[model samples]
Target: MRKRIVRYLLALLGIGAIGAAVFLFMFIRPLPVEVARPAEAVPVQVFGLGTVEAHILSKIGFEVGAALVELNADHGDRVSQGDVLARLHNGEQQARVARAKAGVVNGEAAVKMAQAAVGKARAVLAQKKLTNERKQALLSRQTVSVESAEESQMEVDVAAAELAVAASDVDVAKAALEDARAQYQLETVLLDHHVLKAPYNAIVVERHKELGSVLAPGEALFTLVAPETVWALAYVDEARAGDIRVGQPAEVRLRSLPRQMFEGHVTRIAIESDRVSEERRVYIACDHCPDRFHLGEQAEVFIRTAALDKALLVPETAVEGFDGTKGVVWTVEDGDLRRREVTFGNRTLDSRLEITGDLPDGAQVVTTLHPGLREGRAAKVTEEAAP
Candidate 1:
């Protein structure tokens, strides 16, 4: 009985060992993977993060300080140039304008009174001159006393002096009238300042000051943006920004509308790069952007730089030791894995690298870096797939 029990235990141990061997062979022997082939020349693109911005963004404010009385424009409201946007407590300004007008009227009356004084002085001087002439004539004929003639000449002199003073008064009155008119015009301009008007056709982004609020000079009342001037502002890395040029086609996707892609073209490229981040700002103008857009909305952009009819392409994951323009990739050679040094050209939006070097056509490249994969290792084309 002891020999039989030992034999049964040995048999069970052998069965367990066989099961473990089969399990390892089925599950852990060789890794099953997808293989990639050099694809036909595809379009290469540069990716960037961006935001919606307006070329004409304005912070609307009051030029002069006053108490806000009425707000004609609100957030999200559409406005046109010269549209009344807001109003301040302009009662005092109106009163001042009226007072200025009254002063102008009083100045006109003063000018008329000065003119009348000049006219009266002229008439009196003419009469005095006539008397002086008659007295001189009479004295020449010895018909009047010399004292009388001298008195007549003195009277004429006094009358002439009075007329000159009247003319000077008229000139002073005219100057005073000009000053009053100038004050009236200044007051009218100030009164207009109390009523703020929109400077351009725009959409109100924000209403900063509420009605009945006191505002200082240059205090922002509303933020406005020109809807037609909206565009995408993207930042591209300096390395990739070298090839970017104005008028390049781009695809933009807004965070708010993820599924929708907007078509655009490059409009501007900044000459100066960001010192800290090493990025350059690029502006793109959308062909048919949405009618409504939130300013500063996050966006993603892809700019197509080049398109090739036929070129060797490989998955970026299969590459190693990449140094910007060059990298090493694992290629299947005679069903064996081998590393090849390749110089890269434009990169695709889907992370595919364009190999410009003489890589054999229809060569199978590994899509991933798998462990135990090395040079001269036998590899079977398991899953031939393209992503």
Candidate 2:
């Protein structure tokens, strides 16, 4: 009786399994899927992570090392080019400059004296020549002794030599004057270096040294930025940077002001890329950024690369084997399921990929991925969105 009961139970279980299989094959054969066709007039954008930066930033200081005697500007101060920002101790440099001025004055006096000497020698030489000529005429007429004429000639020769020496002295004096003037100029330049001046129209961002602090050459006393040169720098993934071009519209959101968006445009694209991170550096010039700015502040950037008239977009999560340019995706063709490889183009900021390749006419691309999808299986659109 137990064996008979066991056989009956086994037969019942077998019938139930057969019924389940039949129901699954007949009713569940066609998979319902949500699909999206090509969309029109979609804006394409690429996302990047970056920071607020400036095109012109500077660390300004004195060229010569000295004690900082005065500070005329501090952080947040606005300065114009050639405005005195600070001053080093000018005592020693000033003394040197004064000494050079005295030397220049002395050199001028020497030059004048040498010129006077030259003129005197020339006058003496003229007189000697006159006397020598008169003696020569007297000797030719036998009115003077030959020895007297010879003596006159010797005197004239001596005067001529004196004139040459005086002329040489004049040259030496002029050269000395030039040297003195050059020395004075050099001293003046060094003295000027003791005073730090603004390089351009800038806003002082930082002050590194206090007054009376001694600093080394090229040591920064203040940080400066050209207010007009403020911009945003973005580091975009190289894979998505192929479509970025100069003058494209972009939007920037500073991390400090997360809720606000700043309008900007692409100003420059670096020819080189970050080697380790494989990112391209792009510069965006802000159109109406605030007067106050913080350098190196974190920011988000969205760059509009293209505007699509009609495009089939699939989320990056839906594509299989996506290599940035091409990927495989599911599609519904003739009410049947299929997997097709398609080429991709510009990516939107929300991480959607644009389909650029030829998809079959009247075929709907599966956007909502579902499990158990098989090729040649009957498919139906669960929900369709209006174009």
TM-score of each: 0.73, 0.94
Q: Report the alpha-carbon TM-score of model 1 versus the true structure.
A: 0.73
Query: How many clashes in candidate 2?
Result: 0
Return the lDDT, model 1, position 104.
99
Model 2's TM-score against the true structure: 0.94
Candidate 1's C-alpha runs over 4 A off are: 1-41, 145-147, 309-345, 350-387
Show where candidate 2 strays beyond 4 Å: 2-28, 385-387
For 146-259, candidate 1 gives per-residue lDDT tens digits of: 999999999999999999999999999999999999999999999999989999998999999887899998998899998888999999999888788899999999999999
**CA displacement after TM-score superposition, residue 213 of candidate 2 (Å):** 0.9
Cα lDDT of candidate 2 equals 0.90
Q: What is candidate 1's CA lDDT for residue 43?
A: 80
Model 2 steric clash pairs:
none
lDDT of prediction 1:
0.87
CA-lDDT, candidates in order: 0.87, 0.90
